[model samples]
Target chain A: MEIFMKHFIRAVLVLVFLILQSTFCQFIKIWDIMPNLVLAYIISLALTSDDIMYAGGFGFAAGLLWDITWGRVFGVRTLLFMYIAILAYRAGEYVYRKNISVCVIFTLVGAVITESIFFAANFILTHNASFWQSFFRTIVPSAAYTAAFQLVIYNLCLKISKMGKERSSSV
Target chain B: MNFFKSKLFIVLAIVTVIIVAFMILSAAFGFGTGPVSNGLNIITTPVQNGIYGIGKGISSFFEGIGKSGQYKGLYDESQKRVTELEAEVREIDTLKNENDRLRALLDFEEREKDKKLVAAQVAASSPDNWYAEIQLNKGTNSGIRKDNVVYTDNGLVGYVTEVGPTWCKVLTVLDINASVGCVVPRSGDTAVAEGDAELAQNSECSMNYISKDATVIVGDSVETSGLGSIYPAGILIGKISSITPELQGLYNKATIKTSVDFKSLREVVVIVG
Candidate 1:
């Protein structure tokens, strides 16, 4: 039951990320560029998760939720996010696990991957002749914008992870 | 055999294959009415709206604080202006009614009177350079269907692509996949206005197939020609921002600054045919 509760809480947090990305994040634009809060959340979730399967599971849930609200190319977000989550899990396995800087670096890479896939997928789907143009123009800048917010999000995730660990240890 | 039997390898391989398959499926077939969108939208609409309202309120509150007493004077001016506008609106309504009565008597064709409009509130938006879309609070229940033309007070926004019970999605004019049959009223030169994934980052759209000899100029008004039958004729789409000669000079392509501001758009009206 305790284990189930732990997983359930994590699952619910993914929904919160969806709500924030669609609603609150809309208003928090820097020069008309809104950060991908859900992507940031996914990276953090995957990094903190102990097991690779757990990362994939949570990312799958979060990405699908984002896709539904996004309503653009369905399952595309899921595919991109789960792939990134698993990637982050592999990255964390090799790197030092519980560092603030490490979190930011992983998030930065994850966001870039997510944005690149998003823009690339869009280019292919739309058959835009300016694929390389859009990739260089839109994807790079947007990835940077999304990565900029990783400072606060990564620290916040660290706090939450620590709290969860302390609670589980106490129990 | 060892690699195939490895649990990590198997899982990673499956995930990769799934990702590749999903992308191919999405590119070939669209993401319309997918497995989870409808059920998810139904559950999230109210909560999303509530969050949106709170988000707007908080931002407005902060803005109000930043401006301080300047808003008070503006508010007074706005109130006075509103009263004057209300008076003018009443006079206009009376005149419109008289004109309609005259047109009925003369058996003249009525314009824009038959298009049924379904109102909706924006629930959420995709925030990025990719796939510009808005999720609306009202959907099939409000008579909004697929390909229904969505517009605002200023001009055409886009059309509905997907509809759930209580929510629908609008692919805005800034989306690269959204193409509208457009015309320059000054030259009658027909063209296709599509959302450019590249230019849309700058909040603009691209027009193609415009004749080389056409009188395409900056600031010329573009509107729906009703050629596509999706949007009604004479609805303003945008203004031509620039016209650049493409290679071979067969036709000139232009950029359109869409009249409807997707950045701040909240409420919209969908015309149901």
Candidate 2:
């Protein structure tokens, strides 16, 4: 019952972030580029959670929803989100993920990996001549923008998790 | 709680994501089931649309404040064009009446246009996409189908690539994968407008295959030629921003300043057929 409650709340949080990612991100765009808030949210939760699978499940569900919502191809983001989860967990294990400095680095690196892979997929699928041009101009900047937001989102998720723990223990 | 941190959990998650992904991949590639996916879309599109509308409102708030000065020049130019177009429309209306009279005398059977314009809100666009594609609130239920032309009050946006029950995806003209049939109205020379990777990053595309002797110049308006059965004729595409100075053959090329301001673009009108 406890485990169910925890995962349930986490899933709800992930869904909220997904909604904000698709909706709010469009409005606060920097130079026609909005940061990937969903990616950041998933990565932040994974950094502290020992249950990578639950986080992975959250990511999978979120990615699948995004695919259905906006993606041109199906299952593309599922594979990519898995890669991000594995990378964030493995890298966080060795480094100081809770610290702001190292967390930003991890976020940036994770964003780069995810966005680069996505870019390559688009390039290969479309065979467009301007793939590299879009990569440097749009993809890279998007990574940076998303990394900047990871700071706030990561801390916020941790705080929420802590509060959930306190409430569950009191009950 | 500690059980979730176990190696078993990691393995379990990986397997689950992979399995689901494979199923969806197969569905996308082959052995697809449309009804299931369409059902999912029908469930979520309305909720997504509501959130998307709030997003647009917030975005408009910031953009209007920050970019008001930038739009001043565009506003003045559009006003001038509107006046000129009003006069042109009056002239065309008279000509249309005369043609109808002539056709009536000949007892010609008139054909219905078979076109419906569906107004929709822009649901969402990923920044990672650089506006390459946009999601629309209207979809197959609204008579939208794949390849339906998507445009705005200003000009051409792109084509509907994917359709759902209540939402559709549009591949914008800025995507390197997109191409449209267009022409310079002043010279009446036809050309193909294709997304250029470099220019698309800046929300522009270039026109290709103009006749070398074509009388196209800077600031000349380019519009859909309707040579292809896809888009309606004379729908405004953009203006020739710069003509390629040198040409290797009898054909010429130029860059177009797409009239659609994608950064501020929030609504679209899909031509449903």
Candidate 3:
């Protein structure tokens, strides 16, 4: 029951972020760039998670939900985020996962990677995209904006992860 | 330890292939509006609309407070002006203003009486910056359909891209994928108004393919030419902000400031038929 509760809490967190990203975040654009809160949450969750399957699964579910609700192309975010989770998980093995700075840095890297691939795929498929225009105007700035939230989301995920672990140990 | 041999690595590889295949199929067949997406939207649209309403309310509350002082100052100035003006002259001026405004509204209504328009509130905007689209609270249930034209009182917004049971997505005129057949009413020169990546960020688009020798100039009002079946004629799109020669001086391109203020867009009407 405790384990189920822990997973349930994480699922709820994903939904909240997804809703916030689609709705409230629209009103909070800074310099015409809204932070990708779901991406930030996925990266943070992946970093703090010990199991690769759990990290990948969470990422998959979050991306799938976002794609279904608001994405132009389905499966792109799902694949991108799932790969990002695994990459972050592998990177976490080498670094101290509890470090806030590490989380922030990883988020920055992860955001850039995700945005770059998305842009590339969009450009290839559409053939109407401008590389320099999108890169300077949107991609870099949006990555930084998404990374800014790493501090808060990472800590929240860490706290939740620790809480679940504590309950299991106490039991 | 060979990481490639790990069970988790193998599983991830298989998942990646499946997802990529799904993406290819979705892109090719326009599968983003399939059953899964519709089902999810049905479940999530209410939550999104509710949150959007709350956000709008909170924003409006702060905006109202900020504007109250400005309104107060305007009111005092208007009162002083009213005291200075002759009573008969003031009454005549107010009547003239009201008459002109009513006449304009009546003209627009008379012109659009044949079109079936469904009023909708914006439920949410696209989550990513890659697209400039918004979801409306009304969809197929409300007689809204894909490709239905959406607009505000000011001017053309865009058309519906996808529709679900209770919600629809509108790709605004500011989106890069959008294009409209436009004419400069003053010069009578027709042009194509297309969304630009750089200008869309500023809520602007570009009107292209104007004849180089056309007498079009700055501040010329551009409206739909009705050349295309999608957008009806004479719907005001925007005004020419700047004009520059394009295609080695063969044609001219003018930057247009869209009449509809996308940032403050809340309520819109969709031409269902």
Question: Which docking band does candidate 1 fall into?
Answer: medium
If you score just chain A, what TM-score does every candidate get? Answer: 0.84, 0.87, 0.93
Q: After superposition, how far is residue A42 of candidate 1 from its true place, in Å?
A: 1.6
True contacts kept of 2: 0.41
Poorest 10 consecutive residues by lDDT, candidate 3 chain B: B67-76
Model 1 lDDT per residue over B1-273, tens place: 596897867876887687668757866787667546688889888898888877778887988587555545655768888667666866998899899767753542244557677778888877454668888899888888999989876688998888988998888888867888998889898999988766775678999889878888899999998887687788888899998997887888999998877776787888886
| TM-score of each candidate's B chain against the true B chain | 0.78, 0.67, 0.84
Docking outcome class, model 3: medium
After best superposition, candidate 2 residue B22: deviation in angstroms?
Answer: 4.9
The digit string of per-residue lDDT tens for model 2 on B1-273 reads 696897856776777677567756765684332776577656655676788777767767876587545545655779788667656866898899888767753442222235467889887665355447777888877899888999875788988887887878788888776778888878788999988656875678989888877888999999998877677787788888998855467788899999889767777778886
- For model 1, the local distance difference test gives 0.77
Sort the predicted structures by lDDT, highest score first: 3, 1, 2
Model 1: per-residue lDDT, tens digit, A1-171?
555656666677788877787788788876566778778877887777778887887787777777656745567778778888888888898888777677777876777778776766556654846666655665566667777777777766666656456666887
Worst 10 residues of 1 chain B by lDDT: B104-113
| Interface RMSD (Å), every candidate | 2.5, 3.8, 1.3
Give the range of the ten consecutive residues with the poorest summed lDDT in model 2 chain B. Answer: B104-113
Q: What is the TM-score of each candidate against the true structure?
A: 0.83, 0.77, 0.89
- Angstrom error of the Cα, residue B10, model 2: value is 10
After TM-score superposition, the amount by which residue A129's alpha carbon in candidate 2 deviates from its true location, in angstroms, is: 3.7
- CAPRI verdict on model 2? acceptable
